[model samples]
Target: MSSADSSSSGFVLLGVEDVEDCALSNEGEGSLPLDRFGYVSDLVKKGNHAFRQSRLDMFEQAINYYTRANQIKPNDPIILGNRCATYLRISQFLKLRDSSDSEDRPLSGLDPTIHAELALKDAEKLGEIQSNTVRPFILKASALLLLEKYELARSTVISGLQVDPFSNSLQGALQHLEKMQAGNNGRRSHTKPERTDDFDCTLCLKLLYEPITTPCGHSFCRSCLFQSMDRGNKCPLCRTVLFISPRMSAVSVTLNSIIQKNFPEEYAERKAEHDGLTNFGADLMPLFVMDVVIPCQKYHLHIFEPRYRLMVRRIMEGSRRMGMVGIDPTTGSFAEFACEVEITECEPLPDGRFLIEVEGRRRFRIIRSRDQDGYRVAEVEWVRDLQLPDGSQERVDLLESTNNIAKHASSWLTRARQASQQDRSRYEKLLGLERMMPTPRDPERFSFWLATLTNRTPREKLDLLQLTNTRERISRALIYMRSGELGCRLDLNTITNAPPYTI
Candidate 1:
């Protein structure tokens, strides 16, 4: 059968009317008033309709209805269970949108993460009341997954599966986990067995970053493969012919859903902050300033292509400031919002190429776009000041730690430069020092830094960029960085075929 047909066949829909019937049947017990049952049914319909229309306000209204329904039929499994599902869905949609728009500004205001956490707590309480219900368990598992508590998601799903062995959804989730585990294992097993030296690349380790895998399945950092590829499109180890196009591996959707469910509070907060930043300029017009958007957190961008070269020249001639809007690789469309970037460094290369560095300043959203002399121009509105959550000092501390780590790394680089006695330009020296400096006012910078230090995949980094609050972003970043550091260090022996030592 086709995928659509299979999907339609796999799950049964339980409508508001069915829910009402169930509640009405229980009304004969005199436990709930008949009017309350009708009210709940109406509320459920409204909530479902609002969800279908993507009306956030309506979802809130539905919540009120469900809340009242609970009062009328206290401890009713169906009421509690369905409400949990609705809340989870609302939370997920909000988070997805927030992440998509996060790069625009520093987030402030309400704590989405805390709200999500509360919602999950409610779900968990309902799950305990109705221990046999699979829906609550699934919702809880999903919430944990959103929080990046993978082990918890895994165990929860397993427990649910034990209760209902033939649940296709549970089975599908398990399979996805297995695939991730296998992929991770394959990477570990393919490394050279006898190199036996710490700090050596597992695939030529030399401090792995911007890792890319060859068609023959060998992986190497971008810098390592750049020169090698200049010679030929073949794997250095296996001589397998390579495909030049870059391909992103598909992430596990089920896993992502779990993360969303588990860590609603963090996810929501980050998303809101990201939206504020990215959508800052969405309402303004007549954008006279040029803009540049860079996705790579490190390295100077070399603009050589005819189209971009012309674009940059026009910006330099027109205005030193430009709008840098990130483009979604999958969609090839500019993100809903962009950031104002100041050109800090620029140089002309020998081959008519230009090397440049731009610093992020404020977030904006594009109101409209126009083609100008073979380049793109966008009108935008600037975002207002972002406000932080109460007790966000801890988040500030995490950012400080990241800055400190970068400073230490810069010091090491400085010593290396001094020892080598290589003559360096003033600009190069400045750039080197700046690499270790964090963007003090930019929360997105913290998120980017966390993604870098944690060795998170590009997709994961993108998710970070989408968050809305500085505190939540920093919190998530710290967690990812610490966990990644530990994971990378723990597997160092296996990765490099060497004995372990303290960093």
Candidate 2:
């Protein structure tokens, strides 16, 4: 709320003297003729006084006053902040009182954890309004520690430490939490306790975050299980052969919950650490397991392989995009030059395969590629032809050369397609090319089109695919067309490994 709005609300501005005067005025007068704002402020003051006296009833009264004030001027962050602070105090004071007693006691329907979370949320709102301070974080981390969430407590304190590194209070809290953690560790070290059949993953040596039971009935952490299986599909503990994959894990929810409830701290820490590892290099693109395609061209794909099917789903979930680089069939790895493709249409089959229609968006060069889970993923930099201003002598000469090469390449393709016209060569049966395809509008596109039509080995076509220069590609296509040395050719009846048609 704006200051003008708040000032015009007719609520009395509270001060220490006003509170003292309120107490005196009530003692003598039957009742004070106070406005709504004054009434709320009085109640808040009473709540503060009650807190000094360590009375729970007064804290509840303060909450009621703020709630009522909130209904009148709902956008006031001050009221919310006051209420949040009140809640934190109440929770802290109650815990201190309970801790002093020798006997354990249960408080019904008044879980301090819930109130602390509320205070943390209100503090977050206050931070949005002004600046985040150390008090709210301290309150929250203390509450979490009281609730036995040691790892969360440590993390919360660490965040506050980042914001205010010189905060002695935050530093002290961290030290205290570390001491508690150290005490626990020291006791665990002193005692060689008997195992309670804890299902800690042998790989991580921590309680399973998402336990996945193997075919052999032994359970492991889902990620640990997947990574182990990726190395080799065998049960890590039993050495039993297993068929497992990432993105698809059969999780044991009951076991997972059991571990979470028992080892909340370890689970929280492990999950945070594992999440960091998994999200590393998240800015990279998913590698589409297919042949090279030129930018701005339409391409169709039939996703049948299990690994590729998973990749399609992942890319579709994101920007509906993925990078395509041809496998150098010789090296069994993708080529350096790549094209990014976007899914235009997708039809899922009953047996889990998909027929997808993809369009080439633009060109990108692979900076690096690596196996993630079962499929390849890459970090790439976009490729763009060097900018040459129109009407420049160099540009005009280049355009003229590109046009001449395009005509020659077209004529060569027309003649080479004669074998298909005579029905001797089934080029039509190969890439659905009954005759020479129409030339693309741009010279760069025309070069790729001719290259795809050219009968070349997969590696040879990839060489044409890797050419980043529009002029260079046109020049290469012209040489192949004029010399008739390894020109574009297709075998319609038999499948061939080359550019254009991707399986």
Residues 1-503, model 2: lDDT tens digits: 11111122111111111112132232232222243346445555655565455456666666666554444334354565676666665555443443223123323224343345455555666556445676556555644554446688788789888889997666766776676678656644333333354667788787676787764778777656545543454678888654333223335545665566666777799888765443434347778766777654556788866567656655543467887778777677677777777775454432345667676766777888788757887888877666577789877776676666555555654555555555632432322231223344355665665555444455655666666687666555444443355544434335332322110
> Which regions of candidate 1 deviate over 4 angstroms?
1-30, 98-112, 184-503
lDDT of 1 at 177: 56
Q: What is the RMSD, in Å, between candidate 1 and the native fold over all Cα?
A: 25.8
Q: Which candidate should be chosen as best, given TM-score against the real structure?
A: 2
- For candidate 1, the per-residue lDDT at 235 reads 69
- Superposed by TM-score, candidate 1 places the C-alpha of residue 251 at a distance from the truth, in angstroms, of 18
Off by over 4 Å in 2: 1-283, 296-302, 328-333, 344-347, 357-359, 404-441, 482-503
The C-alpha lDDT values of all candidates are: 0.48, 0.55
Over 123-156, each residue of candidate 1 has an lDDT whose tens digit, in order, gives 6886787677566566676556444355676787
